[model samples]
Target: MGDTRGISGIGDADDIGDMGGIGDAGQVGDTGLSDGPGQAGDAGGADDAARAEDAGRADGSSGGETLGGRDALLARAVRLRESGHREEARTLLLTLSERCPDDAEVAYQTAWVHDTLGLEAEALPHYVRAIQLPGLSDDDRRGALLGLGSTYRILGKYPEAVATLRDASAEYPDDGALRAFLAMALYNTGRSRDAMEILLHQLATTSQDPEIARYRPAIEHYATDLDATV
Candidate 1:
């Protein structure tokens, strides 16, 4: 089972967020989001980060503070995020985004910071933009798909969540995190049995693959819980 759901379980959104393997395993917001073929922000209590630097840059207030060159800006933004300085990161990334609206990475990272800030409404368009761009790393593209899917869920767009997750799953069926997230969305939309069935199938497959068998316990426990709860 290349399904990376870990044997001990579906775990926390905080934990799952780091699954992206983005700037040191790009993370997501904790709770309900999956590193599923997709994953959000309350990381390290980094979730509820300080709004100290929020200067309405997103609205064009401080949008003109040049973040140096593209590479420098990217490096800085990644560092700010890794260090849990999300507000500053968004500020820098937002400026970078306006200067390079066509740059997919800028668009994506801007959205990432917003999602981290629990500003899904703000993150929404950028994620969508990143997804539509022509050139993106396979992982980053998947990240966008996963991010947008999770964003839709957070925004109560269950149908969009289901659709987007399903689309990503089709492309990466081996991604267990993505599968777990799909199950969560399915369950949310009144498809508990369907969700449980998917987890159970993944569990059975994981049990057969020695390479990933280490994750079996988590899957087994989660499956049983799904059986009981849903």
Candidate 2:
């Protein structure tokens, strides 16, 4: 329920292949993989407040090793987002995106930073661009798709959300949570039958998962109300 939704996991480059499920608190799906928001940098303090701190640091320094550069930029973006200086963060990310055009991580983080700042429209292209980058692991691609789908849902672009989620679900067929998100997207799009099917599949496969069970009521409500509402 935080500003950034959870996704899969995060680790070094070698672990990208095995990364699955959504990220922990403060993490959001970036490439269908679970990654914490501002994963490459410090993420202390409360949401907006932490972002402000990061922005301050980003503005102060720009020299470092490769990892240091990424971390510094990420810190700046988070801080700018926290401080409600979304335009500044966007500008900073734009520069980074240009500098690292081939780096999917940079594009993914840029898109997510924008999403966190509530600029869904602005975030979409970056997500798409990141996903298209070569050498991106499946987990990363999945995370990006999930992020894009969720952003679309927030923008009331339900059909796009459904499509994007469907694509992700196909890639990660065993992920019940991914299916659940897809169901939610479908429900939002007035696709009650499809949504119910996805929900049923998720429930059948994850009967013991309290998280999955938590969605039953909402799914049921959507099913029953389909005709009258959506």
Candidate 3:
């Protein structure tokens, strides 16, 4: 399955700051606090402020600059992936993960690249690492959980898959996509009744969503077959 999470444009304040002189400080002030040839001093102050701002922007000091070397590398890897250079992107992400073993974003992006490359075995540990990252966004954590569960399901680890998907569903209880994935995992694990229940719940809650409606036939088919089996 593709990444269910939507990708938004990165809005690094550093990049904006790098554009130079976008702030009012670079413009001459009319405060009239000084009298003797104050224009030169004001111009000099503006130049200094502009230079400092440029330097800060180049060093990525704005917006708290919390992302470390590994995160930067992973971000570059993501760019490569977006450009359709999958192999190079995978290599960059893997290198970043190796370089910064404790960086969660590095590991997370590595796993994402592995999944894109169909390297399920290599992806599982990274997904687990991503979920364990402290203060990860709920959306990111849920995505990692779903990815892990889906990978396990593909590998025939049905019990693990079900447990992982269940955990993800609990974390994102209102997520129709997570619930749908959980239902599929349940069905694959021989818990057809549970799958039917999940499908029915999804149908009830998301009847108006065109994407959910598209799955109705398969859900109904599964529900009917489950009823017959029981």
Candidate 4:
């Protein structure tokens, strides 16, 4: 569930199937998206582990109602997903989305479910809706961006992915994950200069984080020359 954008969750061009959610379990405004489907790629937002470890809440920032019933249902769904009961979780989320179609959180969760299940085609529109909706939390918003942007990359919609990831970066300037995804999109779209620049920026800024720092050399290599890569 993911990225600088999920505005709410998001990931890389290579499957980015590494699905997951953000925050502690049962936390307020959680995207409630998670539980890995054992897919091939490691590209996705927050991740199944994040969703399993963290609970989701209503879209508090977006003004979606944070009623007790909704919270309970969301928590249950999260548990189900975490426990590898993805279909059950998806079923619950679908019901929730139907009951509250305009609820950005619900839409976001629905998108997450589809994304987790490898239904990138199905997940796209819901991610768009969640992102467009006003009452989303920053995490959810970024996650939506992550989901939407990542899905765009998966569909080979490089321009759309670039635009979406750039929009996400504008909002989440410091998000390394989003930047990496953006780099891939840019590279794919023949915007290697922009891609390398962003990658360099990410390396410079995220050097303190071990996970991100490891990508520095690769980024440097990628940035130094685009034609060679092509």
Q: Identify the candidate with maximal TM-score.
A: 3
- When summed lDDT is taken over every stretch of 10 residues in candidate 1, the lowest stretch is 1-10
Question: If scored against the real structure, what TM-score would every candidate get?
Answer: 0.62, 0.56, 0.66, 0.63
lDDT of 2 by residue, 48-155 (tens): 233323433444632222343444444455455555666655665676676577778768767877887677888888888888887556666766878888888888
Ten-residue stretch with the least lDDT total in model 4: 7-16
Cα misplacement distance, residue 72 of candidate 4 (Å): 1.9
Q: Estimate the Cα RMSD of every predicted model relative to the unseen true structure.
A: 13.4, 11.6, 12.2, 11.9
Q: What tens digits encode model 3's per-residue C-alpha lDDT throughout 92-188?
A: 5665565566766666667877888888888989988877876456566667787888888887888898998898888788877778888889999
Tens digits of lDDT, candidate 1, 1-230? 11111111112434423332221222222221222211113222222121111212323333223232344345545655656777767876776677678877778788888988889999999999988877667777777778888888888899999999999999988777678778888988999988997877677675667855877666666766665664
lDDT of 4 by residue, 1-230 (tens): 32223222222222222222223344423433322434313313224323323332222222212343344445555545555666776776776676577878878877887888888888898899888887888777777887889899998999999999998988998767888888999999897788778778667556788876777676667666656844
Question: Candidate 3 at residue 109, lDDT?
Answer: 68
Q: What ordering of candidates by TM-score runs from best to worst?
A: 3, 4, 1, 2
lDDT by candidate, in order shown: 0.62, 0.60, 0.61, 0.63
Question: What pairs collide in candidate 3?
Answer: none
lDDT of 3: 0.61
Candidate 2 Cα outliers beyond 4 Å, as residue runs:
1-91, 209-230
lDDT of 4 at 3: 27
